[model samples]
Target chain A: MNKTQFSKFVEYLLKNNNVIAPQYNVEAKLIIAELKKTSDFYMGTELPLDSWKWFLLPPKQKMFDYKGEKMTEALPSVKKQIFLGVSILDMQALTLLNQIFEQDPYYQEIKKNTIIIGTSHMPKDNFSEYFAKFEENKLEHLQFDIFLAVQNGGYKIYTGSEDGQRFLDNFKYKDYKHVEYAGPIREEGLDLQMVSVMDGMQNFHDQKIWDDLGKRCISCGKCTIACPTCFCFRMFDKSHLEQGSGERNRCWDSCFYNEFTQVAGVAPSAPKHRLMATTAQKIYFWYEHHFVRTPGTYSLPGCVECGRCTRACPADIDIFQTQRDILAARNKKKEK
Target chain B: MINDYQTHNCKILKVESESSDSKIFTLSLPYKDFSFEAGQYVMASLPGFGEAPFSINSYFNEKKFIQLTIRKVGVLTSEINKKKKGDIIGIRGPYGNSFPIGIAKGKNVLIVAGGIAIEPVRPIILDAVNNPQKYKKVFIFYGCRDESAMLYVKEYPSWKKACDLNVALDNPKSKKYIKGPVTILFDVVNIPTDSIAYVCGPPIMYKFVLAKMLEKGFRPENIFISLERHMDCAQGVCQHCAIGTKYVCKDGPVFSYAELKDFKTWLSPI
Candidate 1:
């Protein structure tokens, strides 16, 4: 589709369905929001400050509500929406999220009702090499509705799911080839870069790198909020003014917080309860979750190399730099 | 179609005060087919007070009821202590891997528990008690702060009939029980080196107890430890209870020493 035709299609989409796209806010900083007009769409090499997580897994969501000790499951009611101009990195992130929350009802509630339209736009600062370039084979593992491969002046469109083809057909767009939804793993097995970093961070220890990050990190957890894949959460119960009533809620929780690992009790019951005591251990835990644990369990890269965390970090603790340091430490240990 | 976070409403069948700060609440399952193995845990909640994971203290074969021996700790548990018989509470999961009873069959079974940690391992003791021929011999080394802090004391006589039960206390009022940490009982008792040991206790206790077990020639693989961490989701999605790649809620609240030794953080000190 050409740029003019695509604009018409987006306008048609905005008129009919809830369309979400990256647009510049008042300060001219890019963010993902509901698109009201074609003029608001901002598709470029610069990645948006926020990823799609805020849409799928809201920062605060009500899991269940109660009245006089009677519990009722209260999942979010979502409308069918369209995510237009999503980048490949974000697509990989969405794929990881889909697998992680495959069993999660709340997440699935939002995910099933949404249609993702991915683009071939690659951010300049991508650390992971696989996503640095867009190709046909790369589409095999990632889950997306429609993909727009960038051409000279327009886009070469491809459909991932039946929903994508239907969406395109509904818009009266020209026929596009459909890509089958292959599972996450490719013939190469897991990504070697992810494996290297995971091994380096877990097996090979680097105290200095973590200590430096610990010193720099303010523990504000802005990085977690900005990162697309940081999905750790803690549940909280809010009591209403009425005696036995309120709602059970969950919000994004950071490992950097001391309370994240607190098992409540006194003396014998609470002994050895808090896991990460110091700031360094907490900071290391955040990285370990992204670099080690996620990859170890899911057989996919936890981090999409988005670099938004570094952008949002107040203290300039670079994730890519830490990964390099982890690899360096591992190599040094191996040489010995 | 399954909602992993959705909990079933269970009525409290009975409630018994176990100690000063702990209560054993037996719950009637909402579903008839509800069953869980030893070492598995459930996320129990009082509507307005949130939820927390508690180990199922009842035996696996207990058809009608499941007992949770909860220490009054934090907001949720403190509220649960106030619940009465016939009161309703929320419960989800028989989550996490259970103790490998199949492997322990035909072998000597050793159980070491400390303080409130004995709740999770009670099922193993009950299993041995119910089916005496399931294992060769059963030994329990239970330690608490003192005699007043001990749990399930009334059941000791019944437990003694089929198994060798030993008790230890940090401070004993009389000369009746051995005085010291549970690790001290290792010296008093004759542990089969080839026996499979199930150990659950405070994290600090694991350091000393595991060292003694390793010194006693028990293979690291033969010993399984139940880990406790602050957990929100009994499913692995929430990273609260993760140690390395293992989710204490899913892959384990119980893990072989072999799996734990390689953990970089969270399970044990590096």
Candidate 2:
């Protein structure tokens, strides 16, 4: 598809559904938001500061409403929406989220109504190998409706699901090839980087690395907020002023907080009984979640190597450096 | 698939006071088919308060009703303590892996539980009680803070009939119970090295009890432990109950010692 046709396609999407794409926010930082015009689209190397997760998994969402003893399911009421200019790395994150929350009613309600449009725009400092270059074979593994592979002047189009083909057909763009949606597993087995990192974290002991990170990391949880795949949440019930009426809600929660691991029934005045008491332990738990637990469960790379955590860190704790330290610890353990 | 988070309404059929702090609540299920294995837990909730995980104390064969032995610990449990018979509440799941009863089938069974942790293993004891010939022998070593904190006192006489039952308390008012912690019972009773042991207790208790169990020649694979964590979503999406790579909510509230020993951070202060 040419630039003119892409612009027309964007216009068509906007007219039919909510068209959200990468655009500059009020602070001149790139973010994913609803676009008013075709000129608002930002197609470039620089990735948005915030990921597209906020749209699918909001910061706070109501699960159900309860009146006294009865509960009514609170499914999201979302119109058909198109996510345009999503980078390959972000697509990986979204795909992982899809798998994790497959049985989730709240997430599935919004996910079914959403369409993802991916771009061939590769960021300069990406760490993952699979998504460094956009390949046709990689198209099947990723969960995207449509993909735009950048050519010299315009773009090469590929359709992942039947929904993508239907959208393309409606726009009379029949030149696109349909890539069958294979499951998230790669043919070559698990991602080697994830395997190595998970081994290093699980098999190897690295107290010094975690202690250093603890000293540096303020535990502001900015990294979790910035990360596209950090989907840990906490649920609570808020009672209205009226008698016996309330809404049960869930909000995005970070492992950095002490309350995350605090045992449920401990009294207020009593000393808190938690899993990770020290700051270093909390930091280790966060890394373990991304590098080890996720890969162990899904056999997919948990960290997309987005490096958003590094960017968001107040104490300048670089994730790449931490990975190196973990590997070093692993090697040291092997030598012993 | 149905929404995993959505809870089923259950009415309290009977509430038996176990102690000053805990109560055993028998709940009538909204649906008749609800069943759970030993060591698995349910998310109990009061509409205006919140939800917390409690191990199902009743036997799995009890189809019409399930029982939860709850200790008043915090906001949710404190509210639950206020609930009486005929009151309505919400519950979801039957979640997590159960204790390895299949492995304990023909083998001798040893159960060690501390304080309120006895709730999870109660199902195992009840199972053994019903099928006395299934195992060669059954032994229960229970420990509590004091005499008043002991659970299922009325069932002890019947339990002692088919199995060897021992009780240890921090402070005992009667000579019938031994003195000291639950770990002390390990020294009091001669545990068969080949017996399958199931332990449930606080983090500190695991350190001593596991050491004693290992010293007694119980293999790591043959010993199972039920871990407690602050869980929100028992479905594993919530990170509250994560210990290492495993979600205690989903992967286990129960795990073999072999699986747990490999975790660098399975319990705090490791």
Candidate 3:
């Protein structure tokens, strides 16, 4: 299809459903928000300031409702939403979230009602070679509704799910081919970069690197907010003015915060009990979650390497540099 | 799909004061045929207050009810402590892997717990009590800050009938109890090196007790330790209780020393 058909397709989607696409805000910064018009869509190589998690896994979600000792499950009541102009890197992040929250009803409620339309547009500073260049074969490994592969004049379309095919069929477009949804694993097994970094962080102990990061990191947790796959959350309860009424809620939490690992103890009188007390320990934990824990649990690369964390860091803590340092420390240990 | 976070309302059957800071609340089974294994815990909560994981302190074989020994440390526990009999509280779980009772059946059982950590291991102790022939021998080493801090004092005589019970206090008021930390009990007692040891304690106690156990010829694989962490979702989705790749909420609140030794962040972050 040419540019005219694509614009017509967007117009059809916007008439009924809520269309979320990358667009320039008032500050001229690219962000993923509700697209009011087809002219506002910005399908550039630059990633948005906020990730797609804000839509799927909201910053704060209500999990349960309680009233007078009775508790009921409060799953998110989401509307039919379409995510357009999603980069391949963010697709990987969404695929990973799908696996991680496979059993989560709250996440599934939002996910089931949503449509993901991926694009072949690669970010300028992309680090993951697996997604550096989009290929037809990579579509099976990713979870999406529709994919718009940028070609000479317009876009080549592929349908990944029944929803995608139905959406295209409803638009009276039938030029797209269907791609079967295979699992997240590639035919060649785990990515080499993911394996090496996971091994380096898990096996090699480098205190100096964490110490340096600890000193530089202010622990504001902007990196966690910006990253696509950072989904750590803490559950809480909010009370209403009426007695015995409230909701059980969960919000995104960062490992950098002191309260992340805090436990119950006699605070003032006794020494506080916290798992990660020092900034070095907390920073190491943050890295360990991305490099070691995620890969070990899901067999997928935790850091999609969109360079969002690097850009979001106020302390100029480059995650790519940290990976290099971890690998260097492992190599030095091997030489001995 | 079933909502994993959904909780069932459990009626508080009875409440008994265990110590100055803690109480034992017996609750009706969340559902019919509700059962749990030793070392497993439940996410207990009240309406306005938040939820927290508490180990089921009753015998796993108890079909009618389960017990939780909650310490008045945080907002949730303090609220739970205020609850009386017939009060309803939301509970979900029986989460995490249990102690290796099958592997420990024919072998001697060794239990070492500090302060309130003994709650999780109470089911195992009750098992040993009810079935004396199930294991060769059962020995318990419990350490506390003082006499007032010791738990299950009323049941000590019943436990002593089925196992070798040793109590240690940091500030013992009399000669009836042993002195120093629980590690000192290792010096006086002669436990078989081959015994399957289950340990649960404060973070500080693990270093000393594990070193003592390792020095005493116990195998790493034979020792199981219960770790504590602040948990939100007991389904392992929440990252609060994660230790390395393992989620302590699901993978374990109890783990063998062999499995835990590999992760440097198990005890604390690297």
Candidate 4:
């Protein structure tokens, strides 16, 4: 691969727009560091626990405001930023997010505004490996506007489509050359044999592992917050003291909460375990099965397998292990 | 062009005290247009204490005004009881689906009513009596807690004159009152398989009548029932009058026994 200096990589991203590089904090956490062309921005070794959605679809984005009887839709415009250092899983997460927010009536406003750039993993410090149980699922290059695959020398660019090609042409890289082939990272295939996880992604719901994990879940909803693809929210209506005007507000919500389905004296999905199991089934098994041929076609955003949910889980429910255990249990159940 | 809401006045033509707590106010509307089929109801909005749906006891053949046989069990009905003569009230609608009178026309109609439930079916009795040739034998079997709870006090003379009427009180042992619960209808009448039965009463009475109907091999579509539950909006939107998927305001304050038989969440509010 024809590679340029990492310093030149910085110059290319800055020329087009503001760039957000994941810089390391003291606690080994990766935070989005706003970088100027001349800024002392050193990308941290680990992928940030956050997905690009904090920019695209924030947890509690106000959709509209209502008072008394008046209502108005909120703006979806955002500043153009080149999000560098995104992993393949992060790219998959964004694709799923686009599908979810773009269906039916279409949250197309968010998609029309943002430009996404995909990157191969390049870590220098403590990094959490997220693809252990998700190796076989190759990141579909079609999802992003631009793809950056990292090798030993430098980054090889692969423009997926017209939008991607135009983006790279505009965001011109200094002292960089295009190569026909992009090689793997220097420490390649260290754990590549466990790639069969692509197959493991399908049978997640009917596998009794859901009920077992769901029973122990405290319904805290920490996993959803830390997740890269959870996009469910609630609409709130507020009124002025005069009772003349009111605004409807948009806020993040968890399916785990009691009130999520507290309308009509009966909830379509109710009780704690049912919600969790159904969520897992809907996201993990249902979406993957329904959309395996054309992923994200119907807007079911499954976990990107980011592995952050495992860390955020106070109940110590490792989604990775839970998924593995589910597979194991299925085999056992089959034998019975 | 007055935008402010106004009340139309109605005279309290007569007051039949239903129970120690309940009463029926037969208000004679001045307008000749006051009409509704059996099993339909009206929303009596009392300006502020809020509007509520009440089953209209329509005796269409005789009555010139709209009559509401209210059980004084709630704030609105209790306030309605205190109203005497020339009382002004606001009313809207003969809302909701009525009892399928055309379907039950030729069938043997076994009419059973308990408590204030007779209010809705009272009109059907009048309509049936007006055209006795349309139906086969019409038998009216009613059981009230006491002699005073039975309504249609003035029409009892004519009701007995026109049809087979069996009225029973809760206590049969007392010479003044016939006793025992009304579960005896299963033995009293020979329910022809082709009979169409109409039942209305308290929740327990409705349930017991359903059991009796089932015991007599009555198909679900052959049985009709009028339901009573708390209702806020007489419109379908408020959702207060929901019984499972069926909106009691629009689909029915009246439904066939078959409709509610399998609806698990009808009264099982979460």
| Best of the candidates, DockQ | 3
Identify the leading candidate in terms of lDDT: 3
TM-score of each: 0.97, 0.97, 0.98, 0.49
Better structure of 2 and 3 per DockQ: 3
- What is candidate 4's lDDT per residue for A1-336, written digit by digit as tens? 244444665676677677776665668666666665534554433667665767666555544444322234555566666666666667767765655454311145556655566676533331224443323224332366566666567666665456656655555643333332222211243222122232333332244554555566777878767777665555444545655454434456654555443321111233221211334332232223222312222322245556777778888987667656655654655567
In model 2, state the lDDT of residue A146.
Answer: 95
> Order of all candidates by DockQ, from best down to worst?
3, 2, 1, 4
Chain A only TM-scores, each candidate in turn: 0.96, 0.97, 0.97, 0.70
Q: What share of the true interface contacts does candidate 1 keep?
A: 0.72
Q: What CAPRI grade goes to candidate 2?
A: medium
Docking class of 1: medium
Error of 3 at A255 (Å): 0.7
What stretches of model 4 exceed 4 Å from their correct place?
A1-6, A36-45, A104-107, A122-141, A171-215, A240-243, A264-301, B1-270
Q: What is the lDDT of candidate 4?
A: 0.58
Candidate 2 lDDT over residue span A1-336, tens digit each? 899988899888888889889999888989889998888889988889889999999999999899989988999899888999999889989999999999998999999999999987888988777778778898788999999999978889998888999999998889887788899999999988888888988778778888888888888899999999899999999999999999999999999987988884334356768777888888988898899889988887889988888888988889988998898899888998
Which interface RMSD does candidate 4 score?
A: 13.7
Lowest-sum lDDT 10-residue window in model 4 chain A: A264-273
Q: Assess each model's interface with DockQ, reporting 2 decimals per model.
A: 0.63, 0.66, 0.71, 0.03
